[model samples]
Target chain A: MTERVRVKTMMPPGHVRTPAYLRGKVGVIERELGGFSNPEQLAYGLPAEERPLYRVRFTMEEVWGAAAETPTDTVDAEIFGHWLERL
Target chain B: MPHDHPSHSHEGMSPSGHPYRADNDTALTYWQRMEIAVRELLVEKGAVTPEEVARQIDTMDARSPANGAAVVARAWVDPDFKARLLQDASAASREMGFDIGPLRLIAVENTESVHNLIVCTLCSCYPRNLLGLPPDWYKTRAYRSRAVIEPRAVLREFGVELPDHVQVRVHDSTADMRYVVLPARPAGTEGLDEAELAALVTRDSMIGTGLPRTP
Candidate 1:
């Protein structure tokens, strides 16, 4: 079994339940906080609290097609700030 | 906007473009007002701490892909792998070393003639491991409602216009199985390596809007 998942909080422009589509794709940590379990941070589509979270970046090509038209190279996505991992 | 004429989607029938069930109009969507009440109740009862909820999200955002370069590369070259992908996407994904986290997954393959679209019927359930967070449109009421009844119209809103002949299939995502749309492999990609072809795949294409390259 994988270790218990640990999510980190990213900077404001807050957090939400990282969509299942984005989990475990090597995004950068947009924010990392000491862990907590507050449910209120889910508002504004992110963490429901001031708990630990991580904001990450992803490219449209990474998430969709490589030929995607974009003004930028990558798209930023946030995760739980963490997850159960295999050692 | 007020109008003298009746609206098309409001006749209280699925065929009339009304997306909600005949009875759903009276219900409070669980994600909005009801969920707020639930959170308040839980916090007041002290059954679950609010901090735990945020922590759960925190853990989620941490794992999103910073890049999709690699997965795209793999799908381009391996015909056997592509066939495997068409059969069972999540299983195929595992072969590529992508962590699916705790979400149930379903991959919809885009063939030459057939098309698939993804939507979240309840809140949003996206295939985060491969695609990342869903776009705001995916979660909005406009998409959730219209996608089911008028998929072609919804896709058009997203800038995908299909021909009269191409059939559209819509999948409404929920908490259970997160879905992804796999675009058909581009032609003229034969001589190119996997990585080269993967570069042509875009996020919008996977959502079933944009077409694959060299179509």
Candidate 2:
């Protein structure tokens, strides 16, 4: 394939766990940071290691713009175990 | 922990001779306990090495306003692209490398010709794949509460002054999906290319606060 395509995900409104803080903001897929089986089902009383998933790197500025002023500046955020599409 | 040996439980008295009370959930900070517990537990369990975590954080140094810049640039250069964005934002965004992720996105166009405002009443639902994250104000209770009741006032805070009847349609984004407002292309930018136009469309403009920059 594309040498292991980089994947990432964001949740829908009501059920999404990722805060709206990161929703709809633009960022690049920094890299594949391994993967999680599914932490949600575990968190919400589901069996552990049951949530299927993907995750990757996204910078804070990519999501917040310049207004997110800070010395550290970049926020290397991790998305989740699922919800991704080709870039 | 103390074990009680009384035949019947005592009421309004301390279990250990020291008053026992509980904190209210509403009075508590949202997810504060969970955040601390998770972070501490992760460090304790050694699931993610501390040094690695620091290294991961170090990578955030590369972030930039390029996405906003790109959006503004695209709006400047192409009329057809802008029209498509106004018509169907998700599809148009894909053309610009923004894959709209798990939640679908609907972009409402606001213009000199027509104005539109967006809000999510049921919490701060949003399209994540296109824009990186929602601003702090977008998630504030003040915004969620007022956008529906007094959109004009909220917009005014962002320096957007609207006419008496610009047909403001306030949409409520649910927890299921989200929205983004595509403010109208400004004047004096009639002949620019797609890249030029995108530069004009700032994050504020997309949220219906500020208008796109002209010239």
Candidate 3:
């Protein structure tokens, strides 16, 4: 079972699927969306390493901080497992 | 402004006694030309069949937001179907005869407390199998960045106003998976039948960029 986690604030230099604004953000695992070939490696035509993908749910507050118009709102993103760290 | 002339033809003689030519109406963009060239080359090289390419194009052309509207309308009336749809979108779409291709499709429901919004931050990844092509704005960099940054404000710009207590959930499709929002049925739509309800569902509503028109 995948667990809720926070995205690591790492700025790796390459083709990445995770958005910049979502780094270091806390979100709960809505569901595991199965594994797929890592897109980062695929972009470079390298051997693709399969990685688990999850639909992560974040409170609007977690992403936008004070700028969030609706503090109670939530957002979900499909992210690979490697970007997430256990909260 | 008056282009309704009875004798509007380009086959006229110019002052220099030369035939006047009309502008090229069927102009292809650089990218479009490149795409056609690549597709044709692939077919010629036996990498892909021309018929297969034509079928794929036809399938894409056959799809529209109306397919999504029909699904949402069915879900509003049938509880069992709604549960199945929320559980497995691709299968549910297929049940209603929608060809979802090979991509994984997920349907997020909007309830009394939670409202669902769909966006593709990386690219314009969407359930095109049902909702047809992504709109021009959906592919904009501003939308991609702002939708995730300030979803509520963005929703407001689209004229979707949720109550303070309602929690808006924005789904950012980033991978092979595609998402479609199953928008909440408007309150006054209780007396409407399935077809009428479907008519009420707009393309923007399915994208969570707008609400169903109030009856």
lDDT: which candidate is best? 3
What's the lDDT for all of these models? 0.57, 0.56, 0.86
**Model 2's TM-score against the true structure:** 0.52
Chain B TM, every candidate: 0.66, 0.66, 0.82
lDDT per residue as tens, model 1, B1-215: 44323545455445435455554456666678988898899989998898998986776575443234355456566668767776667777777777666555555677766677777654766777666777788778787656654566667777777765555655545223456677777767778776667677777777776665662
- How many steric overlaps does candidate 1 have? 72
lDDT of 2 by residue, B1-215 (tens): 25564665666667565446775556546698787778779999988777877765454323233454465456546678767765666677677775444544556666555555556665666554555666788889898766655566777888877776464555555323356666666777778776766767776666666677777
Q: Each model's number of backbone clashes?
A: 72, 45, 0
Fnat, model 3, is 0.82
- Relative to the true structure, candidate 1 has a C-alpha RMSD (angstroms) of 17.9
In order of appearance, the predictions have TM-scores of 0.50, 0.52, 0.84
- Compute the lDDT of residue B165 as modeled in candidate 1: 58
lDDT of 2: 0.56
| CAPRI rating of model 2 | incorrect
